[model samples]
Target: MYVAVKGGERAIDNAHAWLAEERRGDLAVPELTTAQIREQMTLAVNRVMAEGSLYDPDLAALAIKQARGDLIEAIFLIRAYRTTLPRFGSSLPVDTGAMACDRRISATFKDLPGGQVLGPTFDYTHRLLDFMLAADGDVPAAPEMPVDPAPVPHVMSFLNSEGLIAQETCDGTPAPDLTRAPLELPAARALRLQALTRGDEGFVLGMAYSTQRGYARNHAFVGELRIGTVPVEMEIPELGISIEIGEITLTECETVNQFTGSKTEPAQFTRGYGLVFGQTERKAISMALVDRALRWEELGEDDQGAPAQDAEFVLYHCDNIQATGFLEHIKLPHYVDFQSELELVRKLRRDATGQGAE
Candidate 1:
């Protein structure tokens, strides 16, 4: 006999206890530290930070540990934690031109000012599995080169100088905060970039792939892709001075896309841009593609009705936290709804049988 439970408090408590025990699998095995995840599983930590819109590595690592290595859950934890933090002051935008670049490459030009520094990329690596890595691998140290302190000019600037590319204008207009406000349609570039940077990696990748497969195909050429550290500065209100607070690693991608000339303007190349926290080149490049696709309206391109071009559709569905919550909620108790549906089906069958006999 099935006994109906009245209150769910005890059941919920017991379930949480069981989950905690399951999260810590074996008693004999050594526990994984947050530092280990931060250092060893760096990519996972980067994903959590990017999606959570928080730059704290320690907190992101702790979230990963608490969530049992589930990246989406980790992001949720970080996001929830970030909301509790008090706002102090906004930092001035860090200039990427002054970045201490570790890796810089340009697909459009053969020779650049930085001379194509390919620092620590998996581009040329073979996809073979290393047996040593499976069993506490001892890796040799990589050769080091002194980081150049010179400012590397952007590749797009070269094109802009030649008057072959369209120039972007910024009149110091403040960007809208997607986190603070409800998403309105016809989003600006800043808001779109914000959504893309924190959007689900897999979802953004799929949308970019769709654009590449002739679904709003924009001939995207990698103008420049860079990964490096840049200084963050904040203005002191009391002292009237701007001081460097810290430095953070960032990845920036600029994609040059094909352009069509209007009656008022000449034919010039346009650009798609992506900037994200940490060394996330794949996400950066994919973001650039999706960004370009979304800009079809502004650029006077015809609406192809592609998934990537649909801003509302992409932004709404790209959030893993919301999607996971709605999906997982389906597993909750639905006994009453199921019983009602069962009764309706039984009555419908009986009525059909009676009509057939008549």
Candidate 2:
């Protein structure tokens, strides 16, 4: 190879200029409005919000437009911006069980206490692209509707009564924030789920898929999937009562997996859990499967040395931001280390050829 060139500054400047131009197509075309993107490209906004761990739809939409529709890059941008903003205080954890659900379904039961509402899902939509979207379009606005604030009942409440699944008990310990701190080993389920929710959707999906393909096959059934805007409240010790601070969209999935009985107990069902920001069913579902697989040791199942069963394997590899940062950091500059390796190779080859000649 031609001796490496070292004009990184110039290369970066040119690349950035090209990216900027690409992001804003022809100057003639009116720039994409943020409102247009937010309303029309909602799925993209949802993914960004979910991965970025911030729920500002307008900002997410702006990030998507600036990234030129690259969802992961948009997420990265939002996350970077999110880190810079000042934090006031943490809201008391939202009681998702009490969420005013927009959509709810229970695979475990055909008739739950609250009837399942299949609201705004593409699961039944045909895969064909809509012609109306490309042309400046107007679909009739959904009717003016008044919705009552009905509480959603959990699907697992019935199972809990019978003690079929492992009981979930929280001692009310506040979960650690990974953004402000580095991840430590032997993480709790809350920390694990936090990492998975903001994790790369595709990466987590693959890890979950591997579990089902007999890698660490834990027979899992979709116990429930729910999507809705849940009210976040804070109990102001000064004020003495919890008040709703804001609301955020959430996708929650719980998977019921097969469990082996302990010596004193009969066989029972274990659990895999997933929860993420925004209406992201796929990511949430995947998180649940992988979450369940990681619980093998706790559930009295042998650690069959599967990838999903390995806590270290799943938690660390699931984040695209971390993976991409480390992967791309090498592209920045390692000339000092590379030159040392090059010299070593040259010296070894020279000595080997000289010895052969002798």
Candidate 3:
């Protein structure tokens, strides 16, 4: 057996020190504070929390600063830290119907019950460079008005009222935890969504966009995109009731996709759903599209061999953490395997020469 290179320990330590120096850039510049990162680089923090499957903005901000704004590295930091945290208990699913929305809009409906609240979106902004931001320019503050607490009901409810979509069924089966369990083939809705929520943003976005471009195009319309905090609760088995545990900010995107109904059932609109931590409507929307495409099998539609329609394909490639780790691990020593291939080639050459001589 070929021996491997030594000094991985010392090399790792030295690399870490170099990384720290690289992250700092210069000793002359003042260090960025955690609070500053959290406040100023909020979008980065939102991404880390969304991808890391954690809800702590503060921790995500710290991780981003430490990683020097390398989002993958920030995600790694958050994932590592999240693994260290204890799972005290599982909270009951948040009642998303009662979301106190900061931003609520529907592409399908021009007007809805709670009128759209376009809170803090860059949708209208030009893609050109904003040179003024380099010097911290400020815009005039708009009038601040408090939103009503009565809750904004969904636009899809109107369709549901007419029995156009499948009515939501509540079966008491406990959902599988992706983090704790290894992902298996043919994932259920809970498993697929869990993977999608923490999945790579860019990858999911591309897959989502592909649907629009006709890769398993289900003719999706954004049914709703809502961002808000929902109360988390836990069932007290002893007390026979659920108590409020805490709250988590979430972005939920529900898409209404066209479905040509099966022989057994009448034609009805199907749903594509995406829910992720933080105010990430883009990721949520992307996720919803992919989710709908993957449901071809369950909905009894033809797969058409599309990437988005393949459950195994989408679930496996969605997360960059896993993808990157596996892809990069190859950088480590593989001399033994290389030597084996070298020997095989050399032996083949020798045999060919010997046969020519004979």
Candidate 4:
């Protein structure tokens, strides 16, 4: 049982004042602005937005600033603020195929339609730390390429055309919103995807790594990975027409797994898909592998009892906010509960020793 403690109002107020002072650390140093965090710390802002399930970069940056760069805290602030906002209409599904890709690549094919375009990525860069950046030296602008007008075709489309890949079909059912309703098991693929996209990156990455390291191994290959901006559209009920709201950057990954076939059916390649906000390639790729692993039952593959294959385990623990809240609560006043436990232990010990309850 938990009990509330009183008579610490003065201490609590002092602690709050101290926290505020520490948050504004180093009076001599220039104060950081939300705009600076939004622009310079773009990746951090993106993470806050992604995990917080909000797309407002400005608000995310502000939260980051208030949280003093503690990302999970920033996410908590954003989520709390998001709860207070009024609901708006949902947007139409984004067309990633029509994305103005910043980076596009295929590992399966050497030369496919819409040739490889490596945008701003750190993949090929050496791990050496540049001292020049520390000195805040001026950097030259990177050369620009002419934008291609044609729509970029999905890499899986080629496989689909050849009847090599298992085709995905939609039943025209509206996808369930986990935000509105509590997560119910056995979740649909759409709901799983929703959870995965907003899941803690480190947790998802570790689960995905487990699959690659021979736990329910699915021989996976990245068919294509792309990052770009896609327009968001929402249909107005009064106007009865769809209008473009805005564009948001996204990273998309499609992984082709080893073929599965029955005696009567031809061997066909299976697939895993991941799409996430911003240029979070690692998170997106990890999401795909875990997604595929979780589909073991539906894909007719053996479960092998992998953690990633356990939907309840993955879905329940993937949320960092929930995990952190439970963890951090232990630091709060548990004195009454501890005292009860302490009394029980002492009584048990005394009983074992044949001592009186004096």
Query: In lDDT terms, how accurate is model 4?
Result: 0.90
lDDT of 4 by residue, 1-358 (tens): 5566576788888889998899999999899999999999988988888889999999999999999899999999988888898897899999999999989998899898889988888999999999989999888888877989677899999999999998898999998987677889989999999999988999999999999998878679999999999999999999999999899999999999986687765899988889988988999999999999988887777879989999999999998888899999998898988998999999899998889456
Clashing pairs in 2: none
Where's the lowest-lDDT run of ten residues in candidate 4? 1-10
Q: Which pairs in model 3 have colliding backbones?
A: none
On a 0 to 1 TM-score scale, where does candidate 4 land against the true structure? 0.96
TM-score: the better of candidates 1 and 3: 1
Tens-place lDDT per residue, model 1, 241-351, is 999999999999999999978988899999999998888999999999999999998888899888889999998888888889989977777788888889999888988
| lDDT by residue for model 3 (102-135), tens | 8898998888897988887899888899878877
RMSD (Cα, Å) for all candidates, in order, is 2.6, 2.8, 2.1, 1.4
Model 3 gets an lDDT of 0.87
Which candidate order results from sorting by TM-score in descending order? 4, 1, 3, 2
Q: TM-score of each candidate?
A: 0.94, 0.91, 0.93, 0.96
The stretch of ten residues in a row with the least summed lDDT in candidate 1 is 1-10
> After best superposition, candidate 1 residue 270: deviation in angstroms?
0.9
